[model samples]
Every structure is written in structure tokens, then in C-alpha cells.
Target: MSHYAVFGHPVSHSLSPRIHAEFGRQTGIALDYTAIEATPAGFAQALDAFAAAGGKGANVTLPLKEAAFALCSVTSERARRAGAVNTLTRNDGQWHGDNTDGIGLVRDLTARLGLDLRGRRTLLLGAGGSARGVAPALLDAGVSELVIANRTPERADALVDLLGEPGRAHSRYWNDLVNEGDFALIVNATSASRDGLQEFSLPFALAASRTLAVDLNYGEAAIPFLAWAQAAGCRDRVDGLGMLVEQAAAAFELWHGVRPDTAGVYATLRGKDASLVTAD
Candidate 1:
């Protein structure tokens, strides 16, 4: 059987295995997908073992995305642009890398949510890999302006410098966000969701009734941000579950040459059947 896996530190909580299983079932392809947790020091060795064991493709998350990028013999332009890789395919004894996060977020926002990003003012709440992965795609979607606010302003500025789209994208300190005015969309791309209800405060001034607030983490991780969005009277709130499914579908297609219907799987996950699949 063809083998696949997701590599991460705290990977036991990942939904990739079940998502891919549903995709395989839908596409009439049988594959083995598992979550493999490895320490930062062990990532390279663990990956080597998986490859030797016939792992054809893999999904990478968190700290491993950048490491995966470094290990790739070839990379897609999007991966280069994001400075990270989330999907890896074995090619002639080498690994080819691609980033599906941006495309996934775009498809979820545009196709699933029916949101028109053209000329929309967006506030991206991080300068980390997750934010970097999606920013270029949002710019490509015709966002009029993107203001990245990070606790460490320099890191955010560094990302703006990389993108080199000065006229449309800029970085701001977290404190200055309140004066930036209302945004059409606000994406929480930081690790804030993982920490739950933090002491951090969002600038409610940046949100209007028409603003769409998105937390790039699902389930309990999304509650704090979504709650703030609701209290601020934002038009809508969403979690990253849709992006997760879409990106997995994209990776599955890349590996197996078939895209699965995400709507059914998404529903199954949201309807509480997600925990039925064991990580091991």
C-alpha cells in the first residue's frame, strides 16, 4: 500500500489522517495515512525513515514546514514565496515541495464562503508561517490593502520586505492596529488560538458589522477569536477547518491525481464524527 503521513511535534491532534482516509474512500484509492510526531531534533531522521518505508507523500505542519522546505530538492514558486512547504511528494528518490495553505484559504473564502476579496482591506494578525502562506494569495485575489500587525513589529516588516508589494501591503505594531480603521476581513493567523483565551486584546475598532473575522485554528482553539468577533459585531466568523479540508484535498489530488468532495468530509468532521478516527 502507498503510505503517507503528517509530520509535526504535537501531531496526535491532527485531522489529516481521517481527512485523507475520507478522500481516499471518495476517490476509490486505498492509502495509509498517519500522524507522526517527532521532536525538532528528530524530524529529519523520522522523515528519512518514512521515505525508506515507502511514504510517497506527506503533509507537514507547524515547526516542520520550514524544515521540510529546507529538505526539499525542488519547490513550487508558492513555497518559495511563503518560505515554507506544507506538502511534499517523493520524486525519483527526491522530495518535491509545494505549499497548499494559500490556495486552500483562497478557495475556502471565495468558493465556500462566497466572499469577494477584490479590493477588500484585510488585517492579518501574524507574521508567522501561517500568515506568510496566505498573504500572497490574498494579494493575488485583489485585496486593496493588507496591514500585518505583530507583537514584534520587525518580523512583520520583514515579511512586507519579502513580498515587496509596498503599495498594498505594510506592517504595523499591534498597538497601532486600532487606528487602522475597520477592515473588511481580519485573519487570526498567530498561535493565539492554540493558547486559548489569552490576555491579548484585539482592536474592536478594526472590525465593523461587515467584517469577516477568521481564526486559522478550529474547534476549541477557535472559540476565543470567534467570541471576540461576535462581541464586536462582525458580520461573520469562521474557523480554519475549511482551509484544512481544502488543503488536504489539494495535496491528495497532487499525490493521487483525484480531488475528493470536501463538503461531505467537512460536514462529517463538523458533525462530531472527527474524533472517531484514532491518530495512531
Candidate 2:
């Protein structure tokens, strides 16, 4: 059986093993998937040891995605654009990196939710790896304009500069967002939600017309954001669970050359009602 695993710190809560097991069973592929807790200082060593042991592929998560990007001998264009990588594959004695977070978000919003992003104003909150991974995909999906807001304005500016002029993307200070008019879509890409921070205030007018509010943090972390959106009168709210499953499917395809049926797997995983599970 081929071996695969997800690497991250505090990986005990990861549901990746179960998700991949379901995928393998459904596709009739024999494989073993597990989660390995790896600290930033030892991530490269752990990856090397995994590859040395004939590991086929690996999914990387928080505090290490950037490290994975640095360790890769080569990377996909999307991963390069995002400045981080979440999936790694062993090929020709080298590890290649790729980012599936963007595609996952796009698939969930466009394919699953049946929402059109073409020419819509978007507000992206946060300036971390999650924000970087999904920004390009949103731009590519034809969002009219994207305003990246962060607590540290410089980071937002840096991200906008990194993305270039691909599709009308810009930066804004977090507090200044209230005066910048409403957005058709608002995405919470911050770890603040995961830390149980108090709800941030946003203009009630922001959700004027079918605004979709999505939080990149899932389970317990997602509750605060979803509740805030609901209280703010934005009915279309979704957690990151769907994005997680979709990204895993993308990673599986990259490694196995076959995309598993994500809908069934996603529904099954979401039904478990677990708290603080890590998908990416």
C-alpha cells in the first residue's frame, strides 16, 4: 500500500486521515494515511525521513506551508503565486510543491454554491498564507475588484504588490473598510476567528445584495464569523470545510492522477460534528 500523511504541529485533531481513507476506499486504491505532528524547526527533516521511507505524497498545514514551499525543488505556478505550498509530491528524487487552496475555494464557491464571481466586488480579510493561497483564484474567477484588508496594512500592500495587476486587486487598512462601500463577497481569511476573538464590526450595508460571507477557519473557529454574519443580516454564510475537502481532492489528483468524488466525502466528514478539525 502507498503511504501518505499530513504534516503539521498539533496534528492530532486533523481529519485528513479519515478523509483520505474514505477516498481510497471509494476509489479502490490501497493506501495508508496518517497525521504527523511536526514543528517548524523539524519539518524539513520529517519530510526527508518520510520520502526516505517511500512516502508517496504529503499534505502540509499551518506554520509549515511556507517551510514546505522553501524545501521544494520545484513548485506549481499557483503555488509560486501564493508564496506558499500545501501539497508536496515526490518525483524524480525531488519534492515538488503545489497549492490547492485557491482551486478548492473556487470550486466550493462557483461549483458547489452556484455563485458567480465575475465582476463582483470582494473583500478579503487577513494577510496570511490562507489569504495568499485564495487571492489569485478569486482574481482569476473574474471578480471585478479585490480589496485586501489586514491589521497590518503593510502586509496587505505587499500581497497586492506580489500579485501584480492580474485582475484589479488592491489593499486597504482594516479600519478603513467601513468607508470603502459594500462588497458582493466578504471572506474571513484571518486566524482571529480560530482564536476565539470577539466579533469585529462591519457595516450592515455590506450585505446589501446576496453577499456571500465565507470564513476560511472551520468548526469552532467558524462559529464566531458565521454568527457575526448572521447578526449582520448576511444569510449566505459558509465554513471552510467544503474548501478543505475540495483542496484534498485536488491534492489527491495531483498525487494519484484521479480526482475522488468530493461531494460525498465532504458531506460524510461534515456530518461527524467534530470540533477544531484541520483540513489543510
Candidate 3:
């Protein structure tokens, strides 16, 4: 069987193996997928070894996304725009990279959640790789204004510069989001949620009763942020679980030349215990 895996610093919690196995079963594509924990220092060696061992493709997560992008001999336009790579495929003696994070998020929000993003004002929390991968997609989805805020304002500004559409997307300091304006959609693209951050501390003023607050983290990692949104009276809240399945399907299509049905796979995973989950 062809081999594949997901690379990340703390990957033991990944649901990717399960997701890919379901995709293989659905599409009748035989493959082996696993999760490998790799710190920043060991990522390159592990990836090189995987490629040398005939691994066809792999999913790159967390701190390794940007590193994977750096190592790619060729990258899709989306990956170039994202400045990160969440999916890696072995091409003709080289690594080809692509980022499906933004597309996955948009599909989950618009198609699965029945939320229309067109003309919606959006607030994105965190300017890290996770935020970088999805910001362009959110802008492309017709969000009226996409504000990228981070603890370090300079990083957010740098991202806006890279995005280069000041009229549509810009940066705001984290402290200024409350005074800036209310948003129809708020996305948490930070690692803070995974760190068990209890107090999101975002201004309730920035959310209307109908505001959709989404954490780009699922399971236990998502609880505190979702609870904060709920306490702030934002009735619409979502975690990143749907995005995980959707993105996996995209990668499966890339590797297998067939798109697996994701609804059943998503439902199957959601029915399991929350403690056994991971998404990136």
C-alpha cells in the first residue's frame, strides 16, 4: 500500500488517520496513513525520510506548515498566497505544496452551516500560520472587510501587506477590535484555544446576537472559546471539525483522483469521543 502521514509537533491526537482511512474505504483507494509527531528541528529529516521511503503525500500541520512551504520545490498559487502548506505531494522527484485550509473553512461555513459569507464583515483573531492560510480565502469569499488582529500588531500589519488589498482586508491591533466595529463573523485562528485559554477576552460589543463565532480548533480545545461566545450571547458558534473533514477530502482528491463523500465521514467522527480529536 502507498504510505502517507500527517506531520506536526504534537500529532498523537490527530483524527487524520481515521479520516483518510474512511476516504480510502469510500473511494476504494488502498493507502496507509499515520500521524507522526515531529518538532521543528526534526521535521525536515522526517519528511525527507518519508519521501525516500516512497511516501506519496502527507499533511503538514501547526508549526510545520510554513516549514513545509519552505521545503517545497513547487507550490500551488493558493499555497503561495497562504505562505503555508497544509498538503504536500511528491511530484517528479520534488515536493509540490498546496493549502486547502481556506477553501475548507469556506465550504464548511457556506455549504454545511448555511452561512453566506458574501458582504459579511469578518474579524480574524491571530496572525499566525493558521490565520495566514485562511485569510485570503475569507477575502475571496466576498467578506466586505477582513480585519486581521494579533497580540503583535506588526505581524498583522505584515500579513495585510502580503495580502495587498487594503480596501478589502486590513490589520487592527487586538486591543482596538472592540472600538473598531462589530463583525458578522468572528474566526479564532489562534493556538490560544488549544492552550486551554478560558477567557477569550474579546469584546462582546464586536458581536451581534447573530454573529457567528468560529474556533479553528475542535473538541476539548474548542470548549473555552465556544463557551465564551455563548456567554457573550452569540448564539451561532462552530468548531473546526467540519473544516478538518472537508480539507481531508480535498487532499484525498489530490492524491487519489477521486473525491470521497465527506458527510458520512464527518458524522462518523463527530459521533466519537471529543478527547480523541485534532485539526489543523
Best prediction by TM-score? 3
Candidate 2 Cα deviation (angstroms), residue 215: 0.8
User: TM-score for every candidate vs. truth?
Assistant: 0.94, 0.94, 0.97
Candidate 3 lands at a TM-score of 0.97
Compose the digit string of candidate 2's lDDT tens values, residues 136-170. 99999998999999999998998898899745989
Displacement of residue 178 (Cα, Å) in model 1 is: 1.9
Query: Of the candidates shown, which would achieve the greatest lDDT relative to the real structure?
Result: 3
Report the C-alpha lDDT of model 3 over 1-280, residue by residue, as the tens digit.
9999999988888889989998998878899999988998999999999999999999988989989999999999999988889999999989999998999999989988889999889999988878988999999999999989999999899889988898988889888777976888899988886665666787778887888999899887888778888887898999999999898888989998998998998888788765744476
Model 3 Cα shift for residue 152 (angstroms): 1.8
Off by over 4 Å in 3: none
lDDT of each: 0.86, 0.86, 0.88
Error of 3 at 20 (Å): 0.2
Greater lDDT among 1 and 3 belongs to 3
- Residue 129, model 2: lDDT of 81
Model 2 TM-score, all chains together: 0.94
Error of 3 at 61 (Å): 0.8
lDDT (Cα, tens digit) per residue for candidate 1, span 1-280:
7999999877888899989998888888989999999877899999999999999999998867878888999999998888888999999999999999988999998999898889889999988778878888889999999999888899899889878899999999898877888999899888875645453378778899999898788776777778889989997898888999998889998999878999988888889854332111
